[model samples]
Target chain A: MNIPMSEPITYLEAIRHAQTDCLHTDERVFIYGEDVEDPLGGAFKATKGLSTRYPERVLNAPISEDAIAGMAVGAALDGMRPIIEFQFADFAILAFNQLANHAGAGAWRHGQPCPLVARLPVGGTPGGGPFHSQMVENWLTTPPGLISVAPATVSDAYHMLKQAVRCDDPVMFYEHKALYFHQRASLSNAPEYPLGRAVVRRQGQDISLVSYSAMVWDALSAAEQLARDYQIEAEVIDLRCLKPLDMNTLYDSLEHTGRLLVCTEAWPYAGVSAEVIAQVSSQAFHLLDAPPRRLNAKDVPVPFHPHLWNAYRPNTADIVQAALDLVRF
Target chain B: MQKIPILLPRLGEAVAEATVQTWLCQSGDTVAKDQDLLEVETEKSIIAIPAPAAGVLLDIDKPAGSRCQVNEVLAWLHSNESDVVQPVDSGSPHAAPTPTETSPTHTPTASLASNSGRHGFLSPRLRALMQEQGLTELDLHLLRGSGQHGRIKADDLTQLLEHLQSHYEPHPAGMLRQAVADSMSRSWNRPLATVSSAVKMDALLAHRKTLPERPSASVYALSTLAQALKEDGRIAKLLLGDQLWQAQQIDLALAIDVDNGIYNPVIQSVDAYSLGELAVEVKRLIAQAHERQLPSNGHNTGIATVSNYGSLGITWATPLPPPGHSCLLGLGAVRRQPDWHPATQSWQCIRACEITLTFDHRIADGGTAARLIHRIVHLLEHPDLLS
Candidate 1:
């Protein structure tokens, strides 16, 4: 629990490590979902070496989410681990009927959790328009059945996926395709992310910017700029989970900063942003300097316009402005 | 149609009340006691009473079937034409009074368990009772459970143990009575005592008519009341009781009156359960009770207790502290019409259920009981707490 965060590594290496380590630790775990074979581990390059190392365990399945998730549910019922992968994050939505409705809530309601994991390649910077580029966390996080985790860094992608693979509950492993090559964190510096705990990527004193997935890097970068430009030490919290949120850490940051700005890829209304603002306001209203703020996409679905879309999600510049406005106010 | 005054039968060995089996005398009919007027079953025996003063029976105060302690009248008797006689406590061919439950005074501890403190809580007799009913030491909090402080006797846990035994279908009075002996022994160790009162259930039943359930419907008062208990403090922990060993979020029990004894079946996990869930469980428990397929227990590390006695206008009833539990609740029948509280001078019209909170003198005082009762009352009034 007290591991350090210093070294930098790529999201790809983290996920591979998570796969191999989990497969090594638990014999019950085996790979499935798509082209998880000897030569190509997956289109996202996450399962690259998994097939070679775990040839017997790595399996390729027909492109049917129902069969895949249902088969995994059966495996878990028999007390086995079934890690599934979808070629594209958006394509994984086809399984939502099973994942969210049936698989997610079946256990807690009936006293036996569905122990499965679906690793989806999520996020847009790879120039994937509505078809391929989509942050699935926005849609999959709040549902009842599975716990959704979208790791932005390599070490997280590695260890958290391992934990999820071993967890008694099913998990939605959403690794950002944008951060796969991210080397900001070294393997040595990787701190284990427990199931439900918000990590403070950058410690600040004046304002708090809460985000998850790839936005952690941007928020941290903005925190650095905000500190030097206006001395507003923005505490950047990387929310690893979209559900069963670690509200305590987030609340503490808001209490200290007295101002809140939530940054995410989803739309503001009825999204994660709404949930955060409501929880913080209800529990820590006395500490607010102004009402909590969130920078998110418009109501329209993620568009194909690269230039116009650049304005849709928050970036380093937008984050800096958010901090600046709070500082000036 | 008939008003019968339920009375406690005279048991040979310090036994008190008797659960009514069936009415031997019909609502409108001539009757003779020696002719099996009605069955009065207790921890002692299932005996019948002779007609007090043979005449055309006018009214039956205590119906044939109820849980009434000894010495209380079973029915009213009147001579034919001119003689007008009041129901006499004595000089009537009725069952005798059980000093244990009906006595105006407390009995000596020696009369309950022995002076031996050694297997105080785990004597062969006590173990037999517990094993028979499926209870454990963890079942009792503190208080060796002996009537005397630091002693564990069968009598301390007798009433509660008997209460648990009554959960079984067609529960044997001998089993209930023996369990009662053990539970009372344990209950007495702690200064915990029970206070029971009856309330009119009409208002609650009427309100129930207002909120219709979606499908598999259930209705319970204790679930709402537990929310009231929570207003006192953040819940410490939730324990489960039953075959599945599901955690009981709400610590409430429905007290059912059977022929040989009284049983209190616990409604599990009211704390985490929604009102709908509570209703469902209450319905299940009641069905089990009616079919005589009831379990032999109400196990939960409960903070409070509730006994529903409003069914037959037994508005006020005494509650026996369940073993290891701190408080017991006795709720009375809802009146067909509301009562005017002369002190408040308010015509409180909406439906109301009577509740009595019996608390451990060792753990909670009357003041604390009042606070708890206030919270429970608040929750019952605002059943939205279930939401």
Candidate 2:
């Protein structure tokens, strides 16, 4: 399904377009989740127009994440492509056993193709309590054989989602709620980027700023500030996919910048940032001028109050300061 | 007569001691205010201490070649008594001498090492410079720092780097050069094929005359090539590791010679830029490249690469595109040559240049590459097509 190139689309609209494209292209591809079929269109309405287009393919599953995930796995095993949507990424915990044990491990254990895509509405929205907001790429990626991708731009949202459905392995797709209506891109300018490939959002020489999901915008902002204020050009890389992490892009960037600063909204210890830094330090030690650094959310649980939440997460200032320190190191 | 103590000043951060390299004035020597009293050496640099007030050198408390701690009394003076120039006892009870002070005692001091650990640490920028200069910690330990508590600041490292750079041959593979090498290596692994076409620049030269700022032929070629790519999708394919990528935005990469190495920084969204805008952006990128401070990271992701060998006064040359790119364009020198003009029915003087297109054979066939070059030459000969 080709979109009219003249119009621009928001990140949410891109998700809808991606689903529509998948449903139209593949007869086996179907969307299953609670309240996803009609007027409700699920939480956040990413599937708002998707159900209207294909009533048979866009489904409304039981309200239980475990049962929904188990059903998706069974359907996928039966040679049907299933896309399971979780209202909020935080609810993925309810189906962790099914997702990690079966969907992720089935391909490894029985040589079966688990062509399933789990759409997770992730990241904190204003006033979104702890139970409603979470970045769960790390958790889903912990299991073997599962691909976790967090798209930063509308173009990536459209491109990567389509690729996720075509993937032979199960994919955990996290869409940032904050970027739902915030980011916009021209449909005409959508590049054909493949899944598991990282893109350099902004280029700089002095430092490499690596991030994924919503935090990519923050990294780009920090890089701009660094260039304007300190004359430090920072390179920003968006790790679109997490599980099959693009180490090549990160290494190539580190080898050029000679310094690396990994930024994430997730907590610092043993998280995505830590894992990236560890690999870069080990693989590109000779290329590094200083120890790699990371900017992450505060270790405390995410608070509900707006002010507390603002302080709890890593913002532009935090990333800029971390990059400045890393470059000066 | 009142005597004033001349103490060793705190040179820098964490510096507890320095060796007296020379005594500018000796006992009984009358020195004016703010005059050189002694010269001392630290781990980073050599510093010369001056007299705080005009006075007669009463005694040399810690003589030359002695290790004196910061604030240790190095000498004594009769305050404001330049006329009474009499030598006093050099060995006063207030004098504290460390073992390394005399006889060039080569004993390694653990204090300096411990001080370096906690207080006088090197910044990352300084450390990077040190690594660039091929300087080790031992070399750092040999120079005296001027920073607080004897810490090595970025400026100090810069000076050391300059000194080392002047004394030895500069490293051939600097950071930027290494980046170029890596990019070239990636490009070299690809199966490259080249196609060339000759274009008459009679219209292009006339078009440049009408513009407010007369842009170079390379700039004109860049604009025309970007237009051609935007119009045709068959030429805008990037192949990497079994994945074929289609270009959403047309970006152009220009290779600039920076005296030392070639720097190819991409000008993004070039298809949307007009001739004037392209000229300014190209000029800015060229300036940045020459300054050796171009912001080059993953920004090298251009749809096609362009090498203006003509600008460097070269004829035809084949240039390879960096990996993940499908095509590259080379512009040779435009020169006045005699050619048969069918419209004039006679030999006429016309400007002509050779345009070479090196493309990845894996993505596009020879026919596609030939068509792309043909489009570019057509756009150049008929400049109205671009406007």
Candidate 3:
């Protein structure tokens, strides 16, 4: 039911195409969530027209959020791979108990595999109110027996989704709403990467900027600014997965630059940035020349006003300031 | 106006005290902020202490040539506000300023190496002079800068170079040549002693004449030296790490010229072959070396080496044995001179060559090395003994 095209697609379209391929490859694979069926194609259209080809597979679930998760776990336990799409990542809070307590811990507790992939449209949009804008990877990753991944590119979105459905345990796939339509990546014979590995988006020698999600682009822009104005070469790393945490690549880059700057869109304390710095300081202590630095969103609720939101979250300028501080220190 | 105390800054982590090489400003002189106030000489480098602020030099606590400890007040300056106040040690308030007791009074050229910590601010010409004189921070601390804003210029470094040439005996080698110095220093780690003897080469010369293919004297000497090394097991052992490896067969490494660079190529198992075979092998190796086709494999495993410095037209010389070799035989050019025939009590002509053997004292004493040299001389003096 999906139309074919020759040109490359946006990251959102890649996610849609990956789901279509998964639905076609396995008879046990099906998509059941709110607005995922035909005429609606799910929110953000990530599952756009898949219901037309596999009508029985893409079923529209009721508005009960708890039942959606409970049923997905039940279907996976009965030998079916179900892809659940929440209308917004913030709405997942309504079903957190069922997703975390049962779907996440079911396999370990009862020996029943929970082969469920819950795709959440995470992160903020321009002028999106507090109800719609939320990044939940840092929270979802804390639960045991759950694989949390945030894909920063089109190829990653396409491949990581196919891998998530194939995995036996539960997976929380966080797709940034801000990058869904704005970001585009070439998918022509893209190299394969593992789930928990990080990628160096740019190579340098002076300082390292480790970030994930949409903040990866901001870190790269800051690295370019540092090169042009300050003559400081900054290396940028994109941590695609949150749970497994690729400390090897981080240490390798830290050994070369001797300074680390971790950036995230979440709050500063007890976030992913805090964990990264803590691990680096404990393990690669001698490799550091100065204290490791980090930049994160202000510790407050997601702002509703446009200017307040810009001030609350981290940007290229914030990343550049943190990089300068680390390099000069 | 608040007076700020100027303390001697620690140039490096290991530096405890530094000598005030020269004072750029005198007491009562008005100095600008960031201006070079004085130069201090530490063991690692020479650093120029800049003025903490625009101020007048109120008093001099430690004058030029005085050695001062870290955080010891060098001077006091009257400024609008005290921008930097590094407190001095309390126990040393009345401590007398000790003048540098180590070296003699400073000369002009030795003082030109001083520079502020601003590394890349030097002009290309000044940097070139620094590189040419091989001056360091410690050397520059002695100079009072004549350039603008305490910048050491080319002319200052040149004058320092001339002054250093007359005063200091050894010049600092640059980074490129430091490897050679390091290896030679490591070579000196072993206690070495040398012994010399004059050997008559009549039988060796006679043997060379008998062969249609005349072989060089080096091959004959190498063959006899290898035979002697094989007979003495103690001399054939090599110190490899903490353990001594006893060589199964003698490998003679000959220092030869390859593409204008001196290369020592090893002829494997030299003692296992006869003198005639060694002559052929030596000729082949030398020819291959000249063609730049000989490999340097197993060159470091040699127990002994023969250095033919005589080929360069020297009559007598002492050569430091290179590292990794237990002994080195320095052979001088053969000279034909008049000798006293003891039986006839008359003067006669004979060909004699000077040979000096240097060995590591750790493996053998002077007397033991002397016996080895004597054994080699006896073999070369009587060529029939080689068989």
Kindly indicate the candidate among 2 and 3 with the higher lDDT: 2
- Winner by lDDT: 2
Off by over 4 Å in 2: B1-136, B139-387
**Residues A1-329 of candidate 2: C-alpha lDDT, one tens digit per residue:** 77755588899988988888899999999999999988988887878877888988899988899999999999999999999999998999999998999999998878898999999998887688788877887788788888899999998999899999999899999999999999988878678788989899998877899999999999999989888877778999999988788999988887667778888887777778888888876776666655677878888777899999999898998887667544533
Each model's lDDT: 0.65, 0.80, 0.77
What does candidate 1's lDDT look like per residue over B25-108, in tens digits? 765666543345577777767877655434556566567567776555566554432211222222111122221223223223
Residue pairs in steric clash, candidate 3?
Answer: B45-B137, B45-B138, B46-B137, B46-B138, B109-B160, B111-B142, B111-B143, B113-B140, B114-B140
Per-residue CA lDDT of candidate 3, range B1-387, in tens?
Answer: 656668776678678799999999999999988899999998877899998778899788899999998656788887775333332111111121112211212222122222235321243444545666564444565654433224443445566778878998984555424533444556787888888899898778998887766768788778778877877746656676898767777776787744424556777888777777778888888888778777656435466778787888887776656677778887889999888999999998999999888887777777778788989899889887776
TM-scores of the candidates in the order shown: 0.45, 0.53, 0.50
Q: Where is the poorest 10-residue window by lDDT in model 2 chain A?
A: A320-329
Prediction 3: B-chain TM-score? 0.55
Tens digits of per-residue lDDT, candidate 1, A210-250, equal 99888888888998987775556889998888787888898
